[model samples]
Target: MDSLTADDFFALDLPRHAQLIDGTLIVPEPQGNFHSVSPYVLAQGLRRTAPGRLRVRRQMCVVIGARDVPEPDLVVVNASADGGPCLMSYAARDVLLAVEVVSPDSEERAQDTKPRKYAAAGIRHYWLVTMDENNRPAVHTYELDPHTGSYAPTGIHHDRLKLAVPFTIDIDLTEIDRL
Candidate 1:
């Protein structure tokens, strides 16, 4: 971790996906087709609301703390005015929101640990997207709690995932399944 930087992480050519947290590498659990569906739907839906000002990036490495550079499933950031290439890395402050889609293999970290890290990094919003017992697209939105420096659950949605934070938008849960 002390020896690695955001640039180093990007330069590596790994055989599979990995994330760098606290100087260690983490490989995500194998996922099925359903795990990929929600991210695509949410990214597309958010893009419709963001229009020309915000950029929605999927699976980009984000530098949170000194050694925490995890690739969030999706991230929403302010678009660059120069209109050049997309950024290679984003500091925590530049991120408006980070979205993580949970799979069976990621239950522990996604639910129990990642939110704390995101909150500690001062990310204003975090959404934990998962499949519920009924297999519906479940989105749980968290906002940073300034006093405690932790995340507070602001909203949970199943059918119509709507929120005013980050931006006002309505995401159809069924669309996630259809996609």
Candidate 2:
């Protein structure tokens, strides 16, 4: 079969998480318990802490290339994205941050593919969250180095996640347990 364009993938009427990467359609498997709740907690935390000009959304698609649209666990974008008609997907350039709560099924994509794509598309911030041995959220953050058009390791937070770039972020990852 032929590869699907981003438009082709997005136009489809589907009810669950999906992405178009390298011109192919990808439907992520149903998330496990932690996977389901962590993104929600993170999004809520960001919404409360981020500057008012930014907006936080859960599981929104970002268009990185003509055939690449990845629905990150959460996306942070400038308020301008909200001023228009409700968007089906936000352009990569409009995204301030792309976050992934890595599930077992998504480790490879979250750690590698998505970051590479995000950096190449000029998305300045990328974060990957995974459960530590004790089943706590460990946030790994990266910032784009425009000179090289690649991401640089910013920090890794264990019990709590904090950052200065992309707006001051302080999230008690433990909140994931409340769900």
- Give the candidate number with the greatest TM-score: 2
* Model 1, position 35: C-alpha lDDT score: 77
Sliding window of 10 residues with minimal summed lDDT for model 2: 80-89
lDDT of 2 by residue, 1-179 (tens): 58988888877886678888899888899999888888887888899898988999888899899989999999999888775556778999889999999888888999999999999999999999888887888889999998999999989898788878888888888887667
lDDT of each: 0.80, 0.88
**What is candidate 1's lDDT per residue for 37-95, written digit by digit as tens?**
88888898898887577789888777897767887889987786223565567778778
Assess the local accuracy of residue 154 in candidate 1 as a C-alpha lDDT between 0 and 100.
Answer: 90
Using Cα atoms with residue i matched to residue i, what is each candidate's TM-score against the true structure? Answer: 0.88, 0.95
Which regions of candidate 1 deviate over 4 angstroms?
1-8, 81-86
Candidate 1 C-alpha RMSD relative to the actual structure = 2.4
